[model samples]
Target: MPCGGGESLEGDAAIYRQLLSISGHRPKVVLICARATELPCEEIAAALLALGAGKVETLTLGARTDGEKPAFLETVENADAVLLLARQPLRLSTLLGGTSLARLLRRRNAEGMPVAGSAAGAALLAEHMLAGGESGPTPRMGGVMLAPGLGLSNRIVIDQGGLLGDRLGRLLAALALNPFALGLGLDADTAAFIGPDNVLEVIGSGALTIVDPADIGHSNIADAAHNAPISMLNLRMHVLVHGARYDLDFRRPLG
Candidate 1:
């Protein structure tokens, strides 16, 4: 339960309550903020240690050069679980999306190590990763979606706030470019954890807005690259109230 503003002492303490329960108490959490320059890493490290982690460490993956690949892998492998803090925006393609940190988080299910993140943290775990925003009359190759995120979120995007104003339309435009994505707008303090079985369950106080464009028809994305107008499409979206569960695997509306 890391906050968008990483200065949350109370929130950090509260998050431990959930983490401890999830880990049966005293879980070893490897808190990673590979792109954090805005906050003091020492403070985050201290907070995790106080949260009853058996062990905790921080990583600056944003600064990692190509040569540090081996060491990075070893550090991630030794961790029991990885928690990516959404302290900064992330570029998925710049990192190849299969790096050590990303790979380790993906194996959380098989290894029994839970991977959790908030905001950008949550966004990075989806099956499709939206690295950054691009503005043009037409979509370009500057932004590309990668397959099978860390697998923590399947094929979804975590929009931390409700789609107010033109956000919804922009998301629709995004889908016009990549039709296979599911854009989820999560209200503040709310989270959707997609289980290993692909069930998306809502947690926390606010609502989870899900825009599922799986039904969109397209032979290839190349057509869109040429700024071709998309055909008629049906996008199924849902606003899951708190404490509700939606099965993402079946693509059927929840009962």
Candidate 2:
């Protein structure tokens, strides 16, 4: 699941409930707070506990020593579910990009371990991550920056805090460059739960915008100069409110 930033503990009740249900009730949950430099472990841990997590362990990847790395890896490997906290996506990529923990997490996810990320955590779940970009009304040639991500999911590129943050331009820019990939713009307090079959179920109070460039006819992205506004046609968009569903592979709304 990918969560937009600013999800309240109360607003995320459904997500939390789903996580527990997927884990077969009150499972061991590992909170990855590597990206959140300002958040305290106690605060996050308390929230998870309140959410009914049986066991909540936090792994701080930011200031770890060589000796401490092995322990972190072990903790993650044993987790029933992994929850990535809010933070900058780049921070996560920089710290855990090629580490053993990264590989372990990927392997676990493949083995069907539940994994969910919020905000930057959500962005890092994609193979092509949205690093940074300017938010505006129009798409521009160089308005969005892309970077390598954790590769948890490759079919979709996610941008959290979407309409709330005016990040539609960034999502569009990403889709224009990676036309084969679908773009998801998540508003604050919203989330997309993508199953193994690539069906995404929307949850929370806000909306999730889908930017599909698969049918795009024309674009000046290749020829446009830096900071030049992009010209594109036939870009498809869909707005999914709470309880809606979409299929990423088919690129269509699912009723």
Supply the global lDDT for candidate 2: 0.81
Which runs of model 1 end up more than 4 angstroms from their true locations? 1-16, 39-51, 66-72, 91-96, 134-154, 161-163, 216-233, 252-255
Local distance difference test values of all predictions, in order: 0.55, 0.81
lDDT of 2 by residue, 94-128 (tens): 77777777788889999889888877888988999
Model 1: per-residue lDDT, tens digit, 1-255? 222222254544544445545664566666666564454557756776777777777766665363147766676677666676654335432452655556555665466666666556656655555444433332333333333445554455544423333245444555655566676665555666555577766666556677778876643445554434334356677778656888777665465
- In model 2, the Cα lDDT at residue 207 comes to 91
Question: Against the true structure, whose lDDT is highest?
Answer: 2
| Model 1, residue 224: C-alpha shift (Å) | 8.2
How does model 1 fare in lDDT? 0.55
